[model samples]
Structure formats: structure tokens, C-alpha cells
Target: MKNQQLQSKGYLMISSTQTIRIISINETFDPQGVKIVYGQGTFSHYSKDGLVEDSIAYRAKGAAAVSVAEAGVNASGVAIGYLDIEVKDSDKGYKNKICTLVIRSFIPTTTANTTFVPTTSAPISPPASEENSKQLVNPVPTVAASNGYVNTTDSSNIPF
Candidate 1:
């Protein structure tokens, strides 16, 4: 399937089919003193129409929390990572669903001394010229899979 960044909303089953750029990481503790880590980043994916972009915030706990913390410590400015999130029916009286964050991979940086500065303006796409015609079309065939999953046969055309 074509790789795409998973959505970061609660009560949804999602996973990163491709690596995502971590713009920032923050660490905190829960009421019980358990460590929690939060990562903020931008996720982009190619849709049948065009490029789709969204802001993502992921929370990690337990073993995943430790991994995110380690990555944040080593990262000079940003980090690149993959995440898997599963939502299940919650047993807690106060909540209806529980979300779990799994860190598949986390790297401090892809290039030396690199930094990411988020802009308030929308992303500018290249002009639709003849040379860029191929990029304007959907690169893969997508099918709706069960449980809110989108499947693509060729992920090679997915833009990271």
C-alpha cells in the first residue's frame, strides 16, 4: 500500500505507513508520575486530487515514552520517526476509548545541523507545467480497506 502519515485524532485506529518529520518534542508527567512525551509535526500525503497536509500531535507513554524522550535528547532541532496508534474501548469510567502510541523508529536528524521552522502560510506547490504533469496525477491506485484503512498497491510514488 502507498505510505501515508496516520491521522492524530483520538478514537481512531491509525499508523504511519511512512516516516514523518518531528518538528518538536515535549516531555511531561502524568498525575501518577508516569512519564509522557508529546511530539508535534507536519504530515503530508498524496491524494487522488492533490497533496494533503495536516498537523499532527502524538502522545507516547510507557516504553514508547522512553524512546521518544531519548530521541528528543539526541535531536538538535528536529527528529524523524514512525508511529503506530491503536484505539481500543476503554475500561476506565471516565473515558470511552484508550489510545496507545507505539514508536517504530526515531532518528535524531537526517542531515547535520538541520532545523525546521513552520510557516503560518500555506505550502506553495510548483507550477503545473508540462514537466510536472506526471506529479499532478494520482501515482497509485487506492482502495478503501476495512476499519478505515486506505490501501495502495504502489507506495513508491508516495511523497515522503
Candidate 2:
């Protein structure tokens, strides 16, 4: 019999606290007929000039799917948490590596703060009234001026 070498064990890759605005959550059956749930959103942060946005996604299955649902990620809203990825052997083969999102703590339908400083190049005005403000789905969070870092407050349940 030929000896087969095992692939390198899976390990965490990148982990960062991010403010995500979940645009949609989708559920579908995989090729194996297993239910898979995932979501697409935008990751926003403040730069030296102004707010910046980027697309983000997460896959939550099994009990994690339930937790994501409970966290209210099913709708369009803001959530802040540690978004991390793990490099692991793909289900198809050991030679391939798959990056999977490791769900940490996510508090949904909430804003980290209510302060925003628009870029000087393109100025943006705040909502005119309370009614108008209520319609804004993506609310800017407060970032530390010195280093552009925002604090994550809801970490009581986070393991690390």
C-alpha cells in the first residue's frame, strides 16, 4: 500500500473587528443536499479622510446558522464583531485550501455610534428629521481619531 501524507492542519488566518451591514441572507441546498446558509454585506470603516466601504460575506451552517439567525443577520442592518477566516483543507481534496468565516460575536440591528465626518472632497449632510434618520440603514460608527480604530463593546460572549 502507498503511504499518503496528511495535509497541514487548519488554522486561523485573519481576524479583525468589523462593522458589517448585512444586505441579504440566503439559504440553499448544497450538492450533497445539505442546507447551507450565508449572507452578503458591506464592511465599513473610517479612513483618514472619510468612511470607506467594502463587500463582505459569511457562511453560517448548523448551529451557527441558528446563532446567526438569532443575531438578526437575516435582514439588512448593521452588526459589529470579529470577522475571521480559517485556512483549511477543502472537502474535495487535501491539496486545496478553503477559507471559512469563523463566527464570533455579532450584535445586529444596531449602530456602534452616531458620529460621522464626511470627506472634505465630497461633503455629505445628515438626515433632516427623525423620520428621515430612521430610514438610514447604515449608520456610521465612532472611530478613534488618532489611529482610526473603533471599539467593539459587545464582547461578553466572545471567547477571545
Candidate 3:
């Protein structure tokens, strides 16, 4: 904290306040084929007036590092911990640049084949599941019940 010496009667001067906001963030899961037991992290907002190391035009590009110190369960049911994320400013003082978050997929080479065949049989066919579509059981028929259907029952037959 910087302080200015008080003159005559002791008093403070030049009080300033700053506000920060998160522009964009890219966060993804990293599964190492293990189960994560716990998860904890932190993020930061970047601005010229904040505690950023460097900034300009009241805006700065920065990132907040986060870690899953304890670990937790992920979508793949793998034990993951020590998660890390960086808090970064999007503007970076460039007016023409558009800010966006990106998540990259990690692909492994030397992949192994899961299924085996005699080179004559075709690959397994995907079975139709409920997620693919909803089964219509005893469906109620309608001439035009749903929305966006225009009724053309003629002017004379039309009931007022």
C-alpha cells in the first residue's frame, strides 16, 4: 500500500477503487483413466487497475491458475485431482481482436483395436435406442393439433 504523508491535521487522500470482470473462460476435463477424489480451484478477473502484473487501457490479458488439489470424479468416472486453470483477460488492449475460449481435444496415436473380426464379418451395427428417438405408443391422431398448422375449413363451415 502506498501512503501519502498527512499535512497539518493527519488525514488520507487520493482514494481510488477498481472493479474487475471475467470476459471469457475455457475450462475442460482431463481424464487420465483414473478417478479424481477431490476438486478445488480459483479464478481471477483481469483489469488495468487490479493486481495484474502488467496492463493497459484499464484492461489486460491475464489468467487465473486453478488446481484440483484433492481430486474428484469426472464425467468418465475417473479419479482426477489437482485441476488447474488460468485466469486471463480477453481484451489485452487490442481493439480489433475478438475474445474467445478454446478447448482442445487430446488424441493418442498407436491406437489399439477393441473389436476383432475374421476380415469377413462387418463391423457391429449401432442398435436403435430411446435416446435416438422417442417411441410413439398408442399415439393420438390429430388433423391439425400442433402449433403453426393453418385451419382451412372454409368460410361457411368456420364457427365464429
For this target, which candidate reaches the highest TM-score against the unseen true structure? Answer: 2
Model 1 misplaced regions, further than 4 Å: 1-17, 31-33, 73-160
Q: Model 3 Cα displacement at 17 (Å)?
A: 40
Instruction: Report the lDDT tens digits of candidate 3 across residue range 1-160.
Output: 1123242346544332222122222334346433221122122345778854321121111111121111111111111112122335567763453222211111122112234656577788776886986677866545446555666666987678
Q: What do the candidate models score in CA lDDT, each in turn?
A: 0.54, 0.54, 0.29
Model 2 C-alpha lDDT per residue in residues 76-99, reported as the tens digit of each score: 333333344335656776654333
* Candidate 3 error regions (>4 Å): 1-79, 92-112, 117-160
lDDT of 2 at 127: 81
Estimated TM-score for each candidate: 0.36, 0.39, 0.14
**Count of steric clashes across candidates, in order:** 0, 0, 26
lDDT of 1 by residue, 69-153 (tens): 6655324223234444335546675434332234544444443345789879888998788785655676554543345566547
Give the Å error, residue 59, model 1: 0.5
Candidate number that wins on TM-score, 1 or 2 = 2
